[model samples]
Target: MESNSSPSSSPIPIFSTFTSPFEGSSKKSDLTKKPLSLWPGMYHSPVTLALWETRSNIFERLLDPPLDAPPQTELITKTPSRSRMTIMYNFSTDYLLREQYRDPWNEVRIGKLLEDLDALAGTISVKHCSDDDSTTRPLYLVTASVDKMVLKKPISVDVDLNIVGAVTWVGRSSIEIQLDVTQPATADATDSVALTANFIFVARDYKTGKAAPVNRLIPETEREKSLYEAAETRNQLRKRKFKDEKKELDNGEVDKFEELLAEGRIFCDMPALADRDSILLRDTRLENSLICQPQQRNIHGRIFGGFLMHRAFELAFSTAYTFAGMMPSFLEVDHVDFLRPVDVGNFLRFKSCVLYTECENPDHPLIHVEVVAHVTRPEFRSSEVSNRFYFTFTVRPEAKAMNNGRRIRKVVPATEEEAHRIVERMDADSL
Candidate 1:
């Protein structure tokens, strides 16, 4: 996507939204809520550190550019300086809970950013920082446009990013935040991995639970203007993309699934109201025929491991729940890999089937499911499986609340090396 300027670049200044409890001057301005409280432990390492980098970098790279106009160029005049800030401190990721690495959320990242903002706003303090000036409350919001992909072991795909965020029009309730993320290619890389987005955060005072006005005017800075332009360009591209995708969907060109199903095993089984339906889905024909579309052609043009897993999980759930007649609990999802990139318009196929289970523990019979999704282009119809995951599900026989009633296992996977290995691992994990 081309980097261009966005219209929402003006920055406002800060003003009070609440009457101090110590001073009873209760003239309510347009400010809606009390400033957030200064709390201990809120701005500690890891979370706070990530927040600091995310916010500071995003602000300097994104906001500063759009808010300020570029210096007028003259034949003899030199170009103007850009707004810039060096890294003052870096925090390790140790403070973040290990479980967070498994299921990361956008809100979690935002919370950390806000915590750092609270410290910068004079509502809080970093424990070890020497600079304790309590008067500076910086204005801006931070966000990420994540296009994640599941990868095979040992290899890593770094998300090289150029972030652009600016304080949009400030208001009584909030300041609109617009951001654009550009993932750059490395020295040896041939293509860019990127996504752009925008966010708006309303400043709130913790005491009154209301909105606060942003009156802080951002000084004109070259960095801010450049970032804003980038955002505008990204926005326009996104709009054009939506139109194109709509056209593709309307054409009824569902190419991948129908072809793969021809060569794959299909299952349509339903048992009485058993809550766990995973054990009965023993159809695995699509695994051998799956293929991954390359990144160049995918609509987003980026292969996100998480997005691929989500699709796999959705298909697994759809197949399993249809047979078991209950909401299946997501017991575990392990061994996810992005074997390849699935591009847009490429024919993609997915296959899911139960592996095996031990009847020794009757209530929770471990169910193993395998998935393979791949892509095939028009020129080269050679399909390759690009994604894989092993999912485990158990039956909840006691759940009468299940709408579909208790489901009982009707079939099991034929014993195989992978099947035996899965059961053995499940047995060990239970210990």
Candidate 2:
């Protein structure tokens, strides 16, 4: 276990020797530096599918999970370093590896990155909760939500990438993990930080499917202490926001939205304002639906949380691209909520919309997009929201001059309810 903090007092032996699925022409490093490659006989396997196999044994031990981690190994306290780990995507030298993560524009696919983060976070959670003397655990972990992920710089698909994650905080049945994505220093440039992400995972008993207690995480250093504190603050904010949504909007908030709604109506009623500069939110919508595939399922037999995020991100990217009339670059993932799990064979529908746009810089507009996932079941007569995702993107610099149609300068809500969502979903810290 390695990070900016101290090493774990007792690190898990298996994680200390874990390696990614790259078995060809690849030399494995210590657990701290597991270099990943796309080829290990599964030539065209989804990068995540192969990586999943590498970490599958951890799941099998828990409730998919025969549950009996050596009861004797259970400790009273665990530190952040105990779960710290890093993996590498050696795309800088592996052409085959780069192909799996690259998009049409030869840039790293944000969707794939989302999947990687989820997979890595899951492993970290397991590492933290593991008793460490058995196959893996007595508890199963699942992603609860992604607090945030922001790109510090544009990630190159052909560069080697390092993903490091560790446990930041833990409650009886919940764990907060933070991940940093960076590029190793090269001859021409110093080490570069590409992205940072925070994810929350909840633990459950394999046998009973009930919330299960995890190890106590005692911060061992100043950095770890700060991270631990921040996670607590963020958790409080999330709970507050959830409660706020159930309350009625105050007079001032309602007035402000009404004014914006009036402006959109004026733009529609007045012929002189129709320049296609502003788009009705409804006009920027795009949708897609698919049956949850078993190949994308996690060890628990439900569609992997990361796979769901992978699909939602691509849809959000498309919404931004079509709305902006240019290629879009991912900026940040503001927030996400996993309301429920989608099982294999379930019909999942993704609805994406251009929630809002900030065109302060005419050449590069910042677009906010929202994606809602619904588990639609006709026989059960329910089409409930299974997930909600919010993402931020901007027009690529080179593509700014390449307009697909009229420039999209604004996105205006056509209804009061839609107006409420736009205002409430905003994260003030990001602003």
- Candidate 2 lands at a TM-score of 0.84
- Per lDDT, the best of the predicted structures is 2
Candidate 2's error at 111, in angstroms? 0.7
TM-score for each prediction? Answer: 0.33, 0.84
User: 315-407 in candidate 2: lDDT tens per residue?
Assistant: 999998887777788988877878998888899999999888887777667899999999999899989999989898987766866554346
lDDT of 1 by residue, 130-248 (tens): 11122332222211122121111111122212233434323343333433323345565544433222333344332233443334334345665665455456446545844763342
Cα error, candidate 2, residue 398 (Å): 2.7
| TM-score computed on alpha carbons, candidate 1 | 0.33
RMSD of 2: 5.6
List where candidate 1 sits over 4 angstroms from the true fold. 1-300, 397-407, 410-431
